[model samples]
Target: MKLQESTMHQNELINLNEYLLTKGFELSEEEIAKLVHVQKEICKNLKWIELDESKLYKIILPYTLSPYLSFDNKMITLENAILIYYKIRSMFDWHLDDETCITTCFKTYTSLYGIQDKELIKTIIIGLKKEGYNNNANDFNESF
Candidate 1:
């Protein structure tokens, strides 16, 4: 995976929270604590923290989002986008126990969002083609 530099911001956090709310994924106190602890460590480390997909799934266990999407034709939903954002965000440096960490988080969020957007557009085109809307799919593909 390519790592693009991004700055985390308050709006990104707000957007993630809103997305989670829509998905009915509210973090428990314990989960919040764990998130904070992990985030602090990431920030303090100031380097990439290794987190494979399984560890990523465990970190986001509070959410109902599944981590087992098939690679070839995987779809990126809001949940996937948010989680991917966090996973990347966890690898960067930031301020511990402060909202200032938003900068690092925002960076990861935007990068992941770009990747996910491309995935989504490709998925949509595939769906359109499968539904026999070849013309529409071709038009959409051209738009990208």
Candidate 2:
């Protein structure tokens, strides 16, 4: 018997998102791309929020819900971005970093904040992760 292998392209498996939107209920390829761009922005913002906590407060403030949050710089580590997404939207508190002392923290930002306009935010977060983010779910899962 011979073993054969087939290849699937990276961007092949996709299910249409009914929640995806434009001015109305429609998402063109360009619109989809735009959504992806928004996700990257959200990821960047999450990272900035974390940096603000780690650097400014000198204490790891519990993550928060930030709908309008954004990172002005394009230098946030992919790891941090993913953590922000998972924590804020999923309410998942896991470690996505090594230097952080504690883990499994609760959200710092208000819950309502994240729930407001959450779909757009979630889309962006998932997009960023797809773009290559390595987050440690344990970061948010650490409690003690």
Candidate 3:
């Protein structure tokens, strides 16, 4: 799938930004663009290839933010953003970086955060189902 196709719409993105504001995070448009870019980059780069664990962490770290900060230059990686979103909101841990894991994390975060726009969540759940994460997909249906 194309990157933008699987990403949030502009208004949904704004909702996300607004949600973040409630958590004391206010990402600028530029930062949000960078986040979208980085997520696309990671997905494109890792689509058919697996990185070693350390390399994967290295690749993912720049996108992570310090949790204590209200604002910073560092942007959250899509994976870590999902992880942190769940962590902060529900105390859930989403630690894996594989495609299914990331997609599920995204679905969970969006659902729990009240994103409400079902297109992205449906897409992510479909992707998970295709990957044989039927249980996970069912959980999303139940939870969201």
Candidate 4:
């Protein structure tokens, strides 16, 4: 679903939470509200032309999973994760290039978050690459 510049309604926020649940994120109501607010703020600040449900999910996915992500025995806090996610989103808005944005996100995470686990970083990069390829393929198919 597309979300314009208007404020999200209660039912729409509930639907967004339900959608996140289907994607394996069981966020609380408060968390869902925060995510919606964050998305709106980002779009407003960046002057994004469009804000879709899929884009919101992609933007907040890392932040949602941040609590479970650890590197070198150090846990990534939600606050830090949110910052990283925002940076990545902003980069995407500026560049409109997935590879560059993803790479910059990885680098920023490693440097600022002190992620010292090389193997973990490698796995994350591989996953991002695979996802990128799949998204490209899907975009190609949908364009036809």
Number of the top TM-score candidate: 4
Better of 2 and 3 by TM-score: 3
> What residue runs in model 1 are displaced by over 4 Å at the alpha carbon?
1-19, 47-144
Cα-based lDDT at residue 128, candidate 3: 48
Candidates 1 and 2 compared: the better one by lDDT is: 1
Runs of candidate 3 with Cα error greater than 4 angstroms are: 1-8, 48-69, 77-79, 82-144
Steric collisions counted per model: 8, 16, 1, 0
Q: Which candidate gets the maximum lDDT versus the true structure? A: 4
lDDT of 4: 0.44
Compared with the true structure, what per-residue lDDT tens digits does model 3 show for residues 1-144?
Answer: 445633535545565556566667666777656755654564454352323322333332223323332444235334455333232222222433444354454455445542323444555555545654433222443332
**Residue 76 displacement in candidate 1 (angstroms):** 15
Q: Assess candidate 2 and give its TM-score to the true structure.
A: 0.26
The sequence of per-residue lDDT tens digits that candidate 2 reaches over residues 1-144 is 122211121121121222222112333456435434544565575563332212211111222112323333111322243444334443322333322321222221233342223343344434435545443343333321
Tens-digit lDDT track for model 1 on 1-144?
233211232333344355455554544445444554654454455454543423333333323333332223222333443343443333223423212223333333343443445454444334334534323112332221
C-alpha lDDT score of every prediction, in listed order? 0.37, 0.32, 0.43, 0.44
Candidate 3 residue 135 Cα shift, in angstroms, is 14
lDDT of 3 at 34: 70
Q: Write the per-residue lDDT of candidate 4 for residues 21-137, one digit (tens) a residue.
A: 654655566765575576566567657644345454444344333333433221223333333444344422232364444454545455445442434333443444555522222
What lDDT does candidate 1 reach at residue 51? 39
TM-score, one value per model = 0.26, 0.26, 0.36, 0.40
Residue 10 CA displacement from its true place in model 3, Å: 1.9
Reference-based lDDT, residue 98, model 4: 44
In model 1, which range of ten residues has the least summed lDDT?
135-144
